[model samples]
Target: MKSPIRIILLILGFIMLLSEGFMGLPFLGGTYILSLGWAPLGSNITMYFVMFLITILDRSNESRSSLSTIAAVDIFANMIAFIPFVGMFLHWLMFFLMLVYIGIVLNTREYRGNTTHYDRHRAGETVREYK
Candidate 1:
């Protein structure tokens, strides 16, 4: 996504988080009653939104592929959390996957090389270049 759009979404997500917290506040110590449960779901969506932003913003080949893979799996898993009787398990799985994603992001390197497919005519030259 464009920087402008990403900025807008980031701002919106922050607002959503703050408002969700405010809405979940309870009066006179009835904290348990203030559980709206929507905040978590909204935050999940916002996380995915951020993922989408990353996918478009980053130009590195390896990074883009990794982010896209994680985002696809995560968003689907989050959606699967709506399934009957398995919602909690699915959510936990998704959360675990999120940690794995973070690790990948932290360690992945930006691949910098000529990405053009090798042609028969250039095969001889390509071998000398990399070797």
Candidate 2:
């Protein structure tokens, strides 16, 4: 769970999407060899971990809107996944969203002795005026 966390989430989301297709199919006792019995739980765990990572890693420079968008995606995916046939659309949309999340994560620049957008936003306003 380091910088590679984003990659891990991407892979997990993709695998979960695929598993949702046939993992529950009735092959052996209504289950397949590649079946993931608790796939939704896995997805939830992975997504929450991602939220945790974002909360801890992001600098003030990072866009709050993007973070909120990631949370929104997680919420929407989880909610829609329980539906019947419509859930399939959510799965595909989620795969695309995973890519979007990765892009946002990759675009977020770390604060390394550099001023951030947040800093610039407050540049004109300060608690104390110059003496």
Candidate 3:
């Protein structure tokens, strides 16, 4: 993924993390919207489903693939959520979570070489090369 996209994903992740905390606050409109019956349940179900999708995506690649797949999934899911009855809020939330997941995947460290080390002093400065 490009650096700019990764940075944007990180920013979105931070926003989602914040929103996740306030999801229960009555002052935040979602709480009221959630109280109106089926929407809340539907939103919860959608969130879990999307989370599962993200997990599957994560497991499919050992390294960050590209921004294309992530962007496609996000945009497609958001479009599906736009249906008036289904509401796009939950889909947006999942999109944000996926952004976070992608950011995490991008930031993870990958070992490029052997990490084990042996002390030269203990071996009296003898130099040995292992192939």
Candidate 4:
């Protein structure tokens, strides 16, 4: 991926992680705002938009699965937000899911593989020799 694209993805991921804090605040806060009925739907819509952008920026197949998982959770939470009693609970559940997704992305082996391959090449083993 291009450097600019990667930077944008990193920024967006940070924003999504930060947004989780809203879930903890008082009324007019995460859950309270969500309880306001339609407003939560709007917030969730914004989240879905951001999530979609992130998904598009992800190039690696392994990373795509985690991004899609996060998108699915966001969509599900938004849909459930239309409910009266269970919306807040679903919101919290989605928040935790996002946390897990972030952790998975950070600890993924994709970056490690690249570094390991570079090290092997640097150690003077030619591609033909490996084969």
**Which candidate has the highest TM-score of all?**
4
lDDT of 1 by residue, 1-131 (tens): 33444354345434533433432333411232225443455556667767666675666535567656766765666555444335445554555555655555545654545777867866667555864
Off by over 4 Å in 2: 1-42, 49-53, 114-131
Predicted model with the maximum lDDT = 4
TM agreement with the true structure for every prediction: 0.50, 0.50, 0.34, 0.59
Q: Per-model C-alpha lDDT, please? A: 0.53, 0.53, 0.48, 0.61
User: What tens digits encode model 2's per-residue C-alpha lDDT throughout 60-130?
Assistant: 53554665566566566656555444555655565566566656656766445634466565678766863
lDDT of 3 by residue, 3-50 (tens): 443455456545544543344343444544445643543454454444
lDDT of 4 by residue, 1-131 (tens): 33454455556566655564464343445556645757756766687677667666667535676667677777767766555446556656666776776665565544322543346555877678875
Model 1 regions lying over 4 Å from their true place: 1-34, 110-131
Clashing residue pairs, backbone N/CA/C < 3 A, model 3: none
The candidate with the higher lDDT, 2 or 3, is: 2
User: C-alpha displacement of 103 in model 4, angstroms?
Assistant: 1.0
Q: Which candidate model has the greater lDDT, 1 or 3? A: 1
Residue-level lDDT for 13 in candidate 3: 49
Which pairs clash in model 4? Answer: none
The CA lDDT at 117 in model 2 is: 60
What are the clashing pairs of model 2? none
